[model samples]
Target: MSEPVKVAGLTVRPGEKARSVLTIPNFWADGQSLEIPFMVLHGKKLGKTLYVQVAQHGSEIMGLDALRRLINELDPGKMSGTLIYCLPNPLAFREKSRATMFDPKPGGMNRIWPGDPEGSLTERMAHKIWTELVSHADEVVDLHTASRYCPVWVFYEADGVSEKAPSETARRSEEMARLFGAPVLYVETEAYGGRRTLRASCVDNGVPAIVPELGGHAHFDEEAVNIAYRGVKNIMKDLGIINGDAELPKRQVKLKWRADPKVYVSHCDKGGVFIPTVSLGDTVKEGDEVGFIYSPRSFETLEKVKSPQTGYVFTIRENPVVHPGERLVSVPEIIEWLEN
Candidate 1:
């Protein structure tokens, strides 16, 4: 039998299910408290513990629905390992804002990892989550959402300075991402800045992690929810936490990262109503006109937005109106195609 796991003042034994909330002290202006809710499922047999969290950014709520469905579907008594589903940032989630609105410097929750107990409000909450939950997990899945036009994909951390030789944790994270069954896999090869992110921090601590960016936000996207559900189940199966094989894509593309100036993202040169000529998942070569910015008043093309490199169009702005220097599209560099 699997041993008992304790977190957030709750102890879950083998073949059991439990839920609890971790209170964040000194969280509100009126001296009220905030709580981070989490669910635990401990299996009957011993296996790797997988920690999955959603809604780090409040508006990104699609993953939460997906997680709810997953929790309902999973049978803890028939499983071999444990699963932790957590909602980490209550302040942002409650306000439906990306950051804690009241904090003086509420950088998005994703930016800070292994946080400081005596730091800002957001940091204090993050610190509690890191120490009490994530630090105990063998693997992690950090769920996020992108624009409505963005396709579902997985991101694994890589060494930007030395892309060829990645750390063992990063390599394991890549394997998990592959089993996640996302159509696109993004390898974030950054040596710095990303270290503070949840997945990167897990990798730095020798715990494999992957961030699955689901499609759309703020609403119930059935397609995105299905994708998230399947991906999590696939990971569990691959990890021997559950029975069955992972249903993955026959072929998936891996994108190489560019940190210097964010070559993946193409910006608008002139402010206007931007219209995209290419849709998400479209392949385009460098210098190809992917979109055009037009002035509604003058009825003239202000500028033609082109692809920065030859790759897949992963993210396109859904909002037509845009200003100069705003991101119009993100086409990551396709490094290779993996056959599954």
Candidate 2:
């Protein structure tokens, strides 16, 4: 049997499940102290540890329901590894905002990893989580939600194919991302470019990590919730932490984009009411008309938004009203298509 696992002042023995909260000190005398609540499941047999976190941004709340379902279904007595689930930004989650007033900057939870104890409030919370929760992870998954019209996808950092041999960590991360079973997978080749994101920090520390971006921010996307729940189980199976085969889609789009993938976003050139003709997951070629901007006042077509590359549509604006420079649709540069 495996030994007991200790984290965040809670000790979870083999074949046991437990919950605890790590309290963060409020330096300001009148400020309320922050707390990060987490759950742990320590299995009977010795195996790897998987750490999953959600709601770094309060508005990105689709995964919470998914995680809730996952927790209810998991059984520590029948498993062979450890599972740690945590809410990284409780303050933001409480207010249903992207970032709280105590944070140093907007969306600071996702930006700061391996945080400093003596830093800002957000940084201090991150520090506690990293040292007390994430440091014990053998693999990591950070869940997030995007725009309402965005399609579900997985993102992991990888070096260019020609740059050098891929590290073991990168290879494992790629495998995990594939097993996640998302319809779209993004292999970012440029790395984080100085961003201290949780996923990047874990990868840098020699632990494999991936981020799954569920769709429909601030709302319950039923399909996304189901996908998130299934994806986590799929990864657990792939890691030999569970007993089952990963269920993947019939066809999946794998985009190995170099540098910044956002460069492929089709932005509205004229301020008007934008209408997107292409739906998410639609494949498109360069110069193909995907959307149009109609002047609401003049009742005339201001511009026809054409796709910038031959790829799949993963993000489309749901709001019809638009302004100059607002994104209409994003068709990232495609590298390969996988079929199972």
Off by over 4 Å in 1: 102-106, 160-166, 192-194, 260-262
lDDT per residue as tens, model 2, 1-340: 8999888889999989999999876645697777789999999988989999999887688888998998888899888999999988877888988888887766557877778899887888889999999999999999988777877889898744323324888888988888888888898877453557888888777888889989755478888888899999998888777789999889888886556544788887789998889988888998899999999899999999999888888788888899898877888878789997
TM-score of 2: 0.93
TM-score of each: 0.92, 0.93
lDDT of 1 at 21: 89
lDDT by residue (tens digit), candidate 1, 55-163? 8887777788878888898889999999998999888888988777544444488777877888878788889999988977999999988777887888887754333
The candidate maximizing TM-score is: 2
Kindly give the number of clashing pairs for every candidate: 0, 0
For model 2, the stretches where C-alpha displacement exceeds 4 angstroms are: 160-166, 257-262
Deviation from native of the Cα of residue 56 in model 1, angstroms: 1.3
